[model samples]
Target: MKIKEAILGFMREQAYKPMDMQELSKIFDINKEEYKTFKKAIKSMEKEGVIVRNRNDKFGLPERMGLVSGKLQVHSRGYGFLIPDEEERQDVFIPSSFMNGAMNGDKVIAKVLKEDVKGKKCEGEIIRIIDRANKTILGVYEDSKNFGFVVAEDKRIQYDIFIPRQKKGDAKTGDMVIVEITQWPEKKRNPEGEIVDILGKKGEKGIDILAIIKKFALPEEFPDKVEKFAANIEEEISKGEYKRRVDLRDVRMVTIDGEDAKDLDDAVSIERLPNGKYKLGVHIADVTHYVRENNPLDKEALKRATSVYLIDRVIPMLPRKLSNGICSLNPKVDRLTLSCIMTIDGSGKVVDHEIVESVIKTSERMTYTDVTKILRDNDEELIKKYDYLVDDFKAMEELFEILNHKRLQRGAIDFNFEESKIILDELGKPVDIKPYERAVANRIIEEFMLVANETVAEHMFWTKTPFVYRIHEEPNEEKLHHFREFIYNLGYVMKWSNEVHPRALQDILEKVKGKKEETVVSTLLLRSMMQAKYAPQCVGHFGLAARYYCHFTSPIRRYPDLQIHRIIKEFINGGLTEERIKNLTSIVEYSSRQSSEMERIAQEAEREVDDLKKAEYMSERIGEEYEGIISSVTSFGMFVELPNTIEGLVHISDLNGDYFIYDERHLALIGERTKMMYRLGDSVKIKVTKVDIDNREIYFRLTEEDHEDEELEIHDDIKESLKSGIYEEKVMAIETGYHDEVE
Candidate 1:
């Protein structure tokens, strides 16, 4: 209360004047009885350094203001923000010109310059770069006469690295390569580097994978010694090893994954108990049994953290022999596994569970497409063609429907998304792009795995065992509020409050089901939420709406899962001491950070591949008219995604026969001469104008009615509202007519 009074009092005194106890009492307009109390407040303020006390019994500004430290988050524009890791509310702002060699994700110290706004965080300038996350640069090589330059793939790098000729080694021009940063010049904008390794040519099969690995500073290849060590691991499952664990070899366990998936990580089995509860078994590949702790293979796995799933291939954390062979839960083979067996009631609530080391013989391997057909179609001839899987598929389908309903009743959100799959030819070119199918059998497997993971997490938490948890914290309150405002503008109401649960957002998603703006709203809602990350601390998962969750189902692909398997095994065997668990507390946190970085790199590489494929697909379709929905809006243009999953930008000039204006806040492009508008999610027909593969850009134009087609022009008011210079540059249209007779 006193601090508030001081701030208000200081604001009133604009001139250079100091306040004494007598003057402060007059400002409060207090009686003589409270004069002594007001004097004590002034003395307290002086002691606290809120105001400096001079020898004349007057107070003035202190020598120093507020200051704080946080990790620097540098954007592509060169400006940065210091996001305090803990309780500091206001982020320190560092202008682009003040960022002293601070790269993105770097830890830095900031000196406060001034407060940004009333009650907001203070703005500051980055004075020192305490640390850098950019140790290695992944770029395309450009060879020169005496030296070479590495053009960074990351747009945020802002400058090309000047590589020394001697350090170029075998790197060739246009090769995707990794360069080590040797020194950063004090005055120059660019940093000097040396080419450490040549990855491959751009667009090559493995180049995207290599680029992502280098981007995250993750290792691409397994070391020679580690590979040798993994190669020596026998595929044989001995009887002695099986005797000490649960033997689920006789149970009808199966693995359901994508047709292209080779590294089978988990298998599942289910049975109804006498009490009407289901006993679900999640059998995960026991990589720890093959690769011992602290060995070369284990060490490598820890460093890599998790498997990178690119568009076409997977860069596994462990060597191929371990991930794809010895530890893979392939069908018809006896494999060692860390099993989480849970007994759940009809409501999908777990009543009992156990983490057991086991040997499982997978009965069959199923694909999502095959199972989807069995469940959706009743064609007698088709069923006869796949008679072997008909019965098992039906059983899996029934179980999935039951569990799904149970999950829904328990307030779980069903965010069924359309995932894209690339079909490649022998030459590695994308022949077709299709939506990935998620069948009932896949859902069955997923449900069983979720139950197992939750059971394991709950057990560990209750036992007070130190372990890694997959945590998804709440979203930023301001972001959620903005999302609510955006949704309200789109004629959809969203419920939000400081005390709202994750389930509340799920409720909004359910209400928007089948709406025209579902995709846009869903995408925006996901952006408003925080990302899930690995941590040693326990926090509820917002996306899944689960109190306890961990990645225990994909050990072959995720290193953290493998580590969890080892920890569970240690605890089950009663071999872990207090010190061992204590060490795991820190180990989990480190692995979580590394795993998150790997995931980010993988996502970037996946996007690159998707963009390339989209460009290729749109190349032949130029000038063909197709209906599409506006997916995004920008100052330059509106992006529309065709039904084929290809998105192209429609320049604002082409919005109508007239000029257009961009409403930045509302994200709409209005016609200048006309009042017509093209906002996000609006449906319109667009013809493919151009496809630039090198730049990963596709351009489109609105089809007009001149002689052969029907079209509408922008409204006059909308056209008149447009600002000049909105379309300063002219966009060229692509020639779509085929030249069969030109030869």
Candidate 2:
């Protein structure tokens, strides 16, 4: 281990005590000449918050010193939670006053105000800032007397930036701008900044998305060098090169994607062997062939890591010349790929497999919509239209069933949360929103990809090669226990303590599949599990219940896939020398970390854009009544989710006729006078009352109900709180840190 890691490991000992630099040097057996270097390592550890220095300049682990070092996730209510850096530690609650001057996303060492038993939330106060994440802020500019205020676009950033008038160059009230922070917040004072870039007026056609792009620090365009490199890549392969590769040009394969998909990165082919076994081939776009290691295009792809699919436009990882032109597995064109061909038994076990670099010409470019119509709807016309590839489609369905059954039998917990697709008009305004479903065709592709990923991951693992993996570590025991109790409160039975298998959770999901509470339960269960990420270790994936997994498909869009493709090609071509493997260790580690971080950024950007557009869509329909299910009950009120997957708050004050009291156990609001109650999963009619586009907030009021016949009386206290925006703030607090996506 390096000196830094050694210092941290030593300090993590259960019986280790705080020690000075000289004492630590003695423990490590450092000589006079090595003392300076050893001392520098200790200082570096201190700066990184891996170790805390007490008043006596003695070092120890932060947790041992009653301190938590983590990224502060401040809610819009000004309060925040410390997501601890140390695994197994609980997230510490940090109240606004205890935040000192730290802003959202700042890495800080917080002094523990309270520590208790395992499951309960611990409280803390930020005592020192380790790193600042926000150097600039993006928001709307509101002019003031001598200064302007910029309300941050992210609700999690509670404070409005104070901007000096002279520094607000070319910006006026209601203009969208990016401001560079000149001073960080202290006490009740907001951080001070100067306008850096005046994007445009607030309501412009594309300014909203532009702000989101800049907020995530995403690349607005490719560098000229990267673009030129992509443009110059050869689209054709030499005869000698074709001769060396396992050519599969005669294989009748098809690419299936969404109707509007531009980058076709994967294709599938399958045929039944004479022995009643199935040979499945998953061909992925060989993006690394053109985007070679350390090239401008490769560097740019790694930097971006993943494509950001905003509803308005796509910020692709690679330049269009590669992502859409040569690299895309377009139909009827010879394309290169790294194929995983598996020979599977009737039970979906991969009896044999081969990972090879090959060339192929796609037989057809199909779509999920059309394929679903043929298989699910039994549309004769569509089946006839694709007569040439109908047999392949049937074979795919048969294999999907076998794979799906195998996964379910293995206790894979599948969370089926409905997704919304925001439709935009020509000018980028929200036209409508609809629920996006997972049809048979979509599931087939998903199953195939999952199997291919597992196959490649297992192959790489056995080879003892340096590789990046998609790992989903086991869930926290505390969270699993909490989920068990919560479900039991709803009349379910389960045992939870140290560990619960994925099969137990899968069974519960099956029971609630078609129930009104399915979405809520699924969402909460997903939150209880750990997030999936790219890592260098093969720890296994909890959600998939898989022993091995990796991103082996869609290399055109995901960097991990592209990065691994190069490694796989090297191994297949017999060039993975010991020296080369040593170099690749660092490369794989860096790529894994970068890919995971960038994926998070892209997911957040996409979710924020979707929320913004959804709010815009609802804003145009104020007062329109819609049927919805009460998704959650809180102190403010219950949140209702419409059939199309749009969620809006129904504040307590809006429950007009009778005074209501919240019941935490059952997650319901009961009217005291009339004994009327609305519980989680209860159907209710609501009319859109208000929309806050800047904050992406939607408000609703319950339609006329049984309580309306009783004496009409609104609670004066609730009304007073609503006027002060207390309702929205409390609801937003409940939603903080619990964002979107399951996989």
Whole-model lDDT per candidate: 0.72, 0.86
Residues 1-743, model 1: lDDT tens digits? 56447544663465647667677667668798877777777666544434555568776653332444456765555566776544335566666676767777676666678876763446677665556768888899999999899888776676689988998989999999888889863445678898888878987875654666567665667889998988787777787998898888998877888788889988877776787777778888888897678899888887777777766667788888877788878889898988888777766667788888888999878776666766786757657876865776665566667777776766666776667777777666777887666666577788777777788888878867777788888776756776777677665676655565766777778877887677666766776777788887888787777889988888877877887887788877876788887787778777877787666666666677678677877787889998888877766788887766778999776665667666643456655555457776678788889998755789999876421332444433334434444332223221110110010
Off by over 4 Å in 2: 9-40, 56-58, 117-119, 495-498, 709-743
The per-candidate count of clashes, in order, stands at 16, 0
Candidate with maximal TM-score? 2
Q: What is the TM-score of each candidate against the true structure?
A: 0.81, 0.91
Q: What is the per-residue lDDT of model 2 for residues 66-166, given as tens digits with 9 covering 90 to 100?
A: 89998888877768888788867778888878999998889999999988656346788999998898998889999988888899887778788988889
Best by lDDT: 2
Candidate 2 CA-lDDT value:
0.86
